[model samples]
Structures are given as C-alpha cells and as structure tokens.
Target: MEMIFIFIIYFVIGLLASTLGAVAGLGGGIIIKPVLDLFGHFDLPTIGVLSAATVLAMATMSLVKFRKKGHKTDKVVSSILAVGSIFGGILGKVIFNIIAISLNMPTVTGFIQSATLALLLTLIFIYFIKKDKLTSFVFKNRLIILTIGFILGFLSAFLGIGGGPLNVTILILLFSMNAKNAAINSIYIIFFSQLSALILIALTTGFSSYDLSMLVYMIIGGIIGGFIGSSIVIKMSNTQVEKIFNISILVIIFVNIYNIVNLLY
Candidate 1:
C-alpha cells in the first residue's frame, strides 16, 4: 500500500509536469528533476534518467496528437535541429559521466548539478521576463538556430531537460511560427535529444542505477498528460499559450533556486 501510494504521487507529478511540458513545448524534465530532488526521492542521475523517459513519452504523445489535428511542422528545420542536438546530447552525457567519476563525492556532485540547473533556469526565467529584442536578432540566422539547438541539446543531456521552452521561443521569435507549430517542432527536437542522451547513458553506465518500476509509472502519467495538454493547446490562442509558458518558467526558476539552497545546506 505504501509503494502504491508513492507511485500514485509520482504519477500525479508526472501528469502535471508533462501537461505543462506539452503545452509550453518545454520537456517535463525541468520540473521532474527539481521536484524529485526536493523530495529526496531519488539521486541526481536516477532522477535524470526517469525525467528523460517521462519527457520522451510526453513528446511522443503530443506529436501524435498535434499531427492528428492537421498541424503542419517544418520537417527540414526539425531534422537539422535534431541532428545537431543528437551529437550535443552524446557529448553532454560524456562530460557528465566524466564529472561523476572525477568528483567521487555524492553530495558535492549533487550540489554542482543543482547549482548548474539553478543558473540555467534563472537565465531562462529572465529571458521570459525580459522578452529581449536581441534574442530575435540572434536567432534570425539559420546557423545560429542550429547552433542554439546543439547547445540546448547539450544542456538537455547535462541537465536532463527537454529544452523545449527555449526551442519554442526560438521558433516563434525567429521563424515566425505560431505557437502550435512551434510546440510540434519542439517535441520533435526533444525526442531526438532525449533519445540520444538516454542511449548514451545506458551504453556507458549500463542502467544499474535505474528504478524501472517508478519509471514505468511516470511514463504512463506523462503520456496521458501529454495527450490532454495537446488537446488543450489546439484550442488555445498564442497569447494564452505564451502566458502559460512564462508561468512555467517562473515556477522552474523558484524551484531550482530552492534546490540549490538545500544542496548547499
């Protein structure tokens, strides 16, 4: 009964995280990692692995739903971005593994990871709040878009996020895509990034640290939430979606800061 109840709670967290992820085109990992860390339910790598699975499931579900609605996506752009991201993901995982081996202290490693997450989330939160014009200019170039995708992919692997929020922003502000189309494309990019990262991790670490049962429950919740969120997004205006996106960023920022503080003390 205790195990069942715990699974239920995890499922609910997965559902909420994935719903926001699908709607905002940010992968659920951003929420999952911090929340799990705060609860002390899992270690960093375990949380990362589980979060990657949840995000992948959510992205896959949302992709199917978005397509069924007759939404058009830029296959060429998504493909190029994904290609860059895959390599980035692999490299990021390599770096993480190296760091893990070198550090040797669990607490110190967790602190470093949490601090990194906090810094990135803080930047993302500021980006959402500032709505900088320089962002538009920087993303205008195709090469820059690809480069950013690669960087985000690295961050996704290193931080175990889907990198969807930044992807959505780039698509909308740079490519002039509407919210729905951006969301669809963001999922495609996230799918590739997470898949590559997961594969690399499995190959290098052999999956000895994973909690398979918890992962299964979380993925189930993510799929359901993604479907529901995609359906909601189909009916929403761009403005409404943007508002939700900003709010999600704000939440991530606060949660990450708290996690960093906890890790410190």
Candidate 2:
C-alpha cells in the first residue's frame, strides 16, 4: 500500500513537471530535481537518475506530439546541437558519478547542483528582463552551435535539470529564434542528450539496481503531461508561451535557492 501510494505521488509529480516542462521547454527536470530533493525520500544521485528518466520520456512524447501536429523546427541547427549534446551528456554523467558515488558526498554534490542551477537561472532571468536592450547573435558556424549544445547538455545532465531553460535561452539569444521554434528545437536537443545519459546509467549501474517501478509511474505521468503540454503550446501565441516561461523560471530559481539554503544549514 505504501509503495502504491508512493507511486501515485511520483506520477502526480511527473505529470505536473512534464506539463510545465513541455510548455516552457525546461524539460521537466528543472522542477523534478528540486521537488524530489524537497521530498527527502531519495539520495541526490537517485533523484538525478530518476529525473533523467522522466525527462527522457517527456521529451520523447513532446517530440512525437509536435511532429503529429506538423509543428516546424530548425532541423539543421537542432541536429548539430543534438550531436554535441550527446557527448556532453556522457561527460556530465561521468562527473556526477564521480562526485555522488566515488566521492561518497551526495550532500555536497546536491548543494553544488542546486547552487549551480540557481546561479544559471538567475543569469537567465537577468538576460530576459534586459533582452530588448541587449544584443542577440545569430551564428551560422556549426562549431559554435556544437559548443553551445555541449555546454547546455553538460549543465542539464549535471544539474539534473532538463535542457528546456538553457536550450531555449541559447536558441533565442544565439540564433535569434522565436520562442515557439526555440521550444521545439529544445525538445529535440534534450532528447538525444538525455538518451545518452540514460544509456550511461544502464551501462554503469544497470537499470535493475534502481527502482524501476517508481520510474514506470513517473513515465506514465510524463507521457500524459507531454501530450497535454504539446496540445496547449501549439495553440498558444509566442507571447503567451513567454509569459509562462518567465514565471516558471522565476519560480524554479527560488526553489533552487531554497534548496541551496536547506543543504547548507
């Protein structure tokens, strides 16, 4: 009964997180990582892995829905970025294991992750408020795009956040992509990155060692959330999507701040 109850809770979390993730392009891990931390039911590494799994499912569904709806994406740019993200994901997973498992310091690792996320989100928020005044670049160079994707993948995988926030920001600022196109491409990039990370997890720890049942529940919720979120975003205007994205970013930053404080004292 307790296990069943826990599954239900996880499903709810996944549903909410993925819904928001799909809408805002934050890939749901931005919410999942911090929320799971607050629950205090699992270790930091466990939370990261679980979050990665859920994000993978959410990304997959979001992409499928976007395709079915005939939403257009920057395929060339997204492809280059995704290729870089795959490699970055592997590196991020390796670093995570080194800290959480090898060093046996999950608490310190958690603090680092939250602090990093908070810092990144804060920077992104600042950029957004001053976006109009600031310059936006459009790089045609493939190498630059790859570098950006690598950085985004490393950050998302390392912090256990989805590629949405960072990916969207980069797309908008670096490529001058509109919010809608950026969101769609964000899903594409995160999918490959998260898949690489999951594969690493399978090779290193083996999926069986972890709580597969918990993931099953979360995945179901993520699928539902992905479908609903895709439905909502396709119909909405760019301005509407940005409004939600702005609000969600602020909320996530605060959550990370709170988490950082909790980890410290």
Can you give the TM-score per candidate against the true fold? 0.91, 0.96
Score each candidate by Cα lDDT: 0.79, 0.86
Give a tens-digit lDDT track for model 2, residues 109-224: 99999898888898988888888898889989999989888888787878888678999999999999888788878888888888888888877788765655578888889889
TM-score for candidate 2, please give it. Answer: 0.96
Which regions of candidate 2 fall more than 4 Å away from where they truly are? none
Give a tens-digit lDDT track for model 1, residues 1-265.
9999999999998999999988878778778878888899776678878898899899889889888998767887787788878887887777776676556565676677777876766676676567645445324456766787788778777776667876787777667676667877888888888888778877777788676668888999999989988888889887788788878878887887887788777
Residue pairs clashing, model 1: none
RMSD of 1: 2.2
